[model samples]
Target: MSTIKRDKGLDNTLKVMKEGYLYTTNQRNRLGADNIFETRGLGGKRVLVLSGKKAAETFYDNDKIERKGTLPKRVVNTLFGKGAIHTTTGKKHIDRKALFMSLMTEGNLKHLRELTRNHWYMNTHRMEQMDQINIYRESIILLTKVGTKWAGVQAPEEKIEEIATDMDIMIDSFRGLGTAFKGYRSSVKARRRVEDWLEDQIIQTRKGKIFPPEGTALYEFAHWEDYLGNPMDSRLCAIDLMNTFRPLIAINRFVSFGLLAMHEFPVSREKINNEDDYAYMFSQEVRRFYPFVPFLPAKAKTDFHFDGHKVDKDTMLLLDIYGTMHREDVFENPNEFRPERFLDWDGSPFDLIPQGGGDYYTNHRCAGEWMTVIIMEETMKYFAGRITYDVPEQDLRVDLNSIPGYVKSGFVIENVKENLDRR
Candidate 1:
């Protein structure tokens, strides 16, 4: 194995912040390394950033790395609440993951799709009354309602906006230093508020004071047992429950990107129809072409070698999710927004992971990935066929430097109208 090239810097955190999603890809190219390179990041810790199919395979190998202790405390508290499934390992992680996987069944997915579609339709009436709508902001509110209802959470109608704002704050807090710190503090309070609410529901469910219907995520997770077969903690149950719904709201970013694509590539909109397959392809392309998570971090479980590079035990490794998706070696003219690329493409987990790569059941891949795709497909179809709206003149440029990117004007739409031709 060849020695890994080291980035000579006391800390590259500023560079990462400045470059955002392009940090790893730019570093690898600048160094002319194969796929792996080392750098010092945040707090001057040794960090290895890697991309491409082989590197992703190595990063996802459970025996070589672990999720625990990899993420920053700020991220843990803000983005993923404490004791979330994102922080677990081994059998504990597997058991907790199973709880989420159980809810992703085909029937449940269809139910979620219907709920999201119905909620979108319900919201469009209000949009028609307005001259313009911010799809990003509107999607967060709409999906929050869809998510809460689908999860069987009995949130009052008045609380929906509050819940959506909290979730958005949590996601936005993942970046920025002092601002992020404040957001983290607020997120902690917000998380506590949400947990307290869910804990009460869990307690009520246990005591039969209230009962969520069977097969709903809230009911199943409330009654879930850990690997030890003990009743799960109410706080952890709430964290997991929030994990389900928060990501559903986060899908708003992709929905925004999908709409932007429709505006930029008007021809692609014609491809999406009532048949979900076309929408699925368009959604896949949106995920690939747009930015979501820049990268995922993990800690080396033991000393290991990959593609002529050595990774020390406990070294922080970043799998470049954004870079991997945009790699020219894998995607032809990747920067272009093309939905048909997925129509005949072979399905490889590593090549197109806007979420995370590998088997969702075994690894740290986002459990809600299927739900995200389903929501995006339904969203695309709704915009393309079920509803009529005009994209108003606005700045639609997405700043690549922004982590969790969004359109500059949030993809504004004017003259929102329902398609009388449909239904």
Candidate 2:
């Protein structure tokens, strides 16, 4: 973590000053990097302002800047680092993001939209007419179908399950909650079955002309150039790109996290409407509200001072993303779900993130963030405009809780209008 200077324009400036004091001085105990820090938590003299954009910018810039080791072992190894997109920062990062945008051009988005419609027809429906609709549950398959179809990916639907199973196995490698430990082993076994299915798709895609010259994600990724040169490292980049749809499809989990925040923190709705960067603000809430990844572990490239304490190279720093969201100094009503704090009086999106902030595609932040936001806005509108589901009665009141409840609790589909009409 880099030393943060309080900046202009945030609602909770004073709280940050107090917390920073506690964190830097020894008045508070050391917050070993792994521990989850509440969004506005004030310990010691240093205040850990999880959502402090300025501090976040400093921390993101400190040391190597775009270290891509925050993901779980499998994903970090398979999809991060130099070959992956998020390792980029600065101007070059903008170029890469632009390239990604080009691929999602008018024609491409058109194709994707068509594909999404087809997918909705094929995969999603009311589980039972009487049973409540769980967009969270349906989101997995819908996102998977849309991703694969839009990317022109040559894989069967079952392979998506393999990816999910793999995620489970990886999650289990660390301590999981209760029965999840058992689920992890089962996931490992399930992955073997997935291998056979994924192999066929891989072979088929390689043999087929699925990657045409125009309008395909494969074409764009396969021909991209960077440090490796014009044709870039096609095989590696493609393999990385092939996994792109998985994250995109699985984006519903992120959407769920955001919506849950909206429902839990009604006060946040005011903030969201006030900003120019509705997309950015919503993106930030996603990063803030959800546990996208449980841990962000990284090997220190060299010795560096974090809040004045020296850490040696190869030391692992655990950046608890969820913890960062709740730090009191960075946000007002840190635990409350308020989106307006991020926006101006006008209703556009502003500073929010799911992927890391500052610069994208070339390094630290996510490449797909723009597209992700588009999808989220559409989904959010669809939900807010169409459905009126039952809010569950629980220990926490829906009126004031940070999160209303699980997707299953009082999760319902009612008062649905045109958007919710599958048929």
Candidate 3:
């Protein structure tokens, strides 16, 4: 076995900050490595960055890597609450994941899609009275309603904006250092308020003061038992609930990108409208073409060799999610926004992981990934066939350097109207 090649410096933290999603793949190209390389980041911690399908398979192997103690404290506290499923391992992870997966039944997915469709219609109807609409902003509000309703959380009609802003802060905190601290503080405060509210709701449900519908996420999580066969703590249950709630809202990013794709590629709109399979293809293309999560982090479970390179125990491993999805070896014409590429997709877990890869039930893939696809497909179909909106002058450029990047102008649309032809 050979020693892994390292990017020598005090740390490559500055490089990572500057390059963002391109960091690891840039290193691989610069070093002339076939797949894996090492670099230091964030407080001079040694990180092994991996790319490509086989590398993803190795990175996600539960026996080789674990998630607990891997993420930054700021990320854990803000983006994923402390003690979240993102920070569990072994049987604890498996059992908690089961609780989450239980809520993703086909019936539940259909319910979520219906809620999203209704909420989207209501929001667009209101937007028709206005001069312009920011799809990014409107998506947050619309999906927040869908998420809260689907999860059976009860926020007052007046408090929806506040709750939505809080979730946005949690997601926004994961970016640059200058704003991250401030964002983190805002996230902490928001999480506290939300968790407190959820804890009270769980308690009320248990005490019969309020009853979330049976089989709803809020209800199931409230009453879920942990691996030890004891009722999960109310606070932890609240975090798990937010795990479901927040990601659904985060699909706002994809909604923005999907709408942007329709504006940029007008030809796709016709295909999506006329064919159901094309909608799926369009949604998958949106996910693959856009930048959302930059990378996934884990830690070595023990010293191991990957592709003939030694990786020491407890060393940080960053999987290049963005780069992997765009790898030329895996995607033909990797930079283009082509939807037809997915028409015959083979359903490989290791490839096309805009979200993380591996088995959703056994590994660390996002539990709400299926729901995200469903929501995106519905949004694409709505944009293509059901609604007509004008894409006015706006900065549609996306800053790839920003973590969880958004279109510069938030993808504005004017003269919103229901498609009279479709009606």
Q: What is the lDDT of residue 143 in candidate 3?
A: 85
Candidate 1 per-residue lDDT over residues 123-160, each given as its tens digit: 88899999789999999989989999989999898999
In the range 174-264, model 2's lDDT, one tens digit per residue, is 3322112454545445434433443444444455644444456655665566543655443445544644554565466666666666677
Supply every candidate's count of residue pairs whose N, Cα or C atoms clash at under 3 angstroms.
0, 49, 0
Q: What TM-score fits each model?
A: 0.96, 0.63, 0.97
In angstroms, how far off is 77's CA in candidate 1?
0.5
lDDT (Cα, tens digit) per residue for candidate 3, span 114-233: 987777777777989989899898889888888999999998879898888888888888885423355567778988888888888988988988989998998998888886889988
Clashes of 3: 0
Ranked by TM-score, the better of candidates 1 and 2 is 1
**Candidate closer to the true structure by lDDT (higher is better), 1 or 3:** 3
